[model samples]
Target: MVIKVERVLHMVGGGGETSYATNSRLQEKAIYRTKPILEIAVAEMYRTLLPEKMVVVDLGCSSGPNTFLVVSEVLGIVGDLCRRLEQKPPEIQFFLNDLPGNDFNNVFRSLERYEKKMEEENGGLLVPHYVVGVPGSFYGRLFPCNTVHFFHSSYCLTWLSQVPQGLGSEQGVPLNKGNFCIAENSPPQVVKAYQEQHRRDFSTFLKSRYVELSIGGGMVSTFLGIKSKHPANDELNYLYGLVAEALNAMVSQGIISENKVGTFNLPIYGASMQEVKSVIGVEGSFDVEKAESIWDPFDDSDNVLSGKNVASTLQAVMEPLISHHFGDAILHELFSLLADIITARHLLKDKCNYTVLNSNSLSSCHRRHGH
Candidate 1:
């Protein structure tokens, strides 16, 4: 009885203006964190490759809002760097990428809006070469070999389309035969499996980047990560399992069905800094110009004190998990009740206090020569 979870579609643009507000806030945070890193990355790419014209690609570009922010920032930095180096600024061809199911219509609209702004401000001569939409995973190759000068992906790599099979409610077991699970109190085997999967996924990701980027090119990535040496008992994974347990309890109470509960899974993994570096370094392509762990204050806060906020935040974070485990048939009333119960009795209230870490505090090591 292998119950496979369904892919959860994140509600991006559905209702009126309000529906897009949450996504907009999230996008803003993503842009803010990624902007400086991208500036450094593009400047490094130009310095190292010294190409006459550089082509930049934004992998997992999602909507044009965030993509444009990164692209514009990178161009500004590259322009400044070119002036310092006494060279012509590289012509940038922006590639906005995302999964095929993403809201590209909105993305294209956003691009048009930014394009107009650029033309109006720069007298149309400073306009970037814009190719509106390119769809695919960043973990796979989507462009010509060695065509991209700089690549950037932020808050995107943690997601895979689906949780690996033989885990969660569908599998009915904590430990798969060969896979690792990172749930709270997860067995040693389970944790090992999860780490192994991350290693594999990251290796593939690096190999793909190696193919996509030319020699001496670099990438700047920022993702949700954990701080754990041992594979078992990771706090973040435990948090997810706790949320999953609450959802399952709702299913048992007839508030949702087993089939519905098994419809979605959390589409993310919080890898530790060491784990990310290990995988990327082993690939031997990227120089790892910068690698650092920074906390997202917005995400770390304990805003779930109020019932309404709890329910809303729970719905935002756990909706994918719920939709992955349970079908979309769960009633709103049941979801609210489950959220209330979890907040009242089970949520980690004390550990909710979060502080933002300095970006310079990141542990950065360059790639060794020849890999």
Candidate 2:
């Protein structure tokens, strides 16, 4: 019943209403907001190691306009620093990574345009930047040991490799039933199960990256998080909770089987700032330089259209996963349910449902590596 995330998770690519390339303005804004931190990371890197040749990798880099934005920020900073240092810009080996199912064709098609922009903006300092697509998962090694210099991953760490191992019973019944993710009403056991899965998966991720980063090499990561450690403080439940409610409504009218709702859960976790730092600390491979909660999703806007936006955005990001689990027949109904749920849920914008996390793990190896 478990779908390999590498085969199931990806944004809808291309120019369409549900396409991430078209509707990821919110994610693009989030990336823009993190530019300052990215600049700081790159600047600090130049202070110590200004190599004539450099290597940078972007993990979980889905295909879209947002995919290039982070690395572009890093590239700009590197270019500026080189000019100030009176040093020739480095020949960057940039890798854009994501699941194998990602629409890499779309990204590759956009590169000429991106390069043209970079050349004009940087005075041709980026003349020889070499970019390639790397398909894989960050939960495991994707590059050679000690090879990468700067690694950037944004808005993707919250996805678990699989559902928590112990959320089911001896009879094969779900222990954390009726919800797609952890929620306020979830039992303590359910909470612990999710926490443990995040810990293990994140630990694996750090270990792999630790082996890949050269000394003084660093990473800047942004992912979904929570305002507090307590499960009750979860702010992301409104969307999933509403999804569950909609299904329940259907079940009440015998529209869908109750067994379907009981058996499904999203392999995602919205960790608290504490959870993020704690894993970095426990993983023992990287040092956490700066870790903090950046912005509140609710505070980002009270747009009456947020529900629609949320549905469109998530559908673009998660349709593959949903369809893999429940089949495409339910997509229309499911998203309609989600849109209505967001429209009705009125927990003020600041209640902390969705949060952007900031973490700079300043930690490589070289033999081909990735993820």
Candidate with the greatest lDDT versus the true structure: 2
Clashes of 1: 21
Q: Candidate 1, which segments miss by more than 4 Å at Cα? A: 1-11, 14-21, 24-27, 82-87, 117-127, 168-181, 230-235, 258-267, 299-325, 334-348, 351-371
Name the top TM-score candidate: 2
**What does the lDDT read for residue 50 in candidate 2?**
73
Please give the lDDT score at residue 86 for candidate 2.
Answer: 86
For all predicted structures, in order, the TM-scores are: 0.77, 0.91
User: Residues 90-189, candidate 1, lDDT per residue (tens digit)?
Assistant: 6677788777756677767666777777667656634246565787666667888877766777666666544554454325633432112355455554
| Ten contiguous residues with the weakest lDDT in model 1 | 354-363
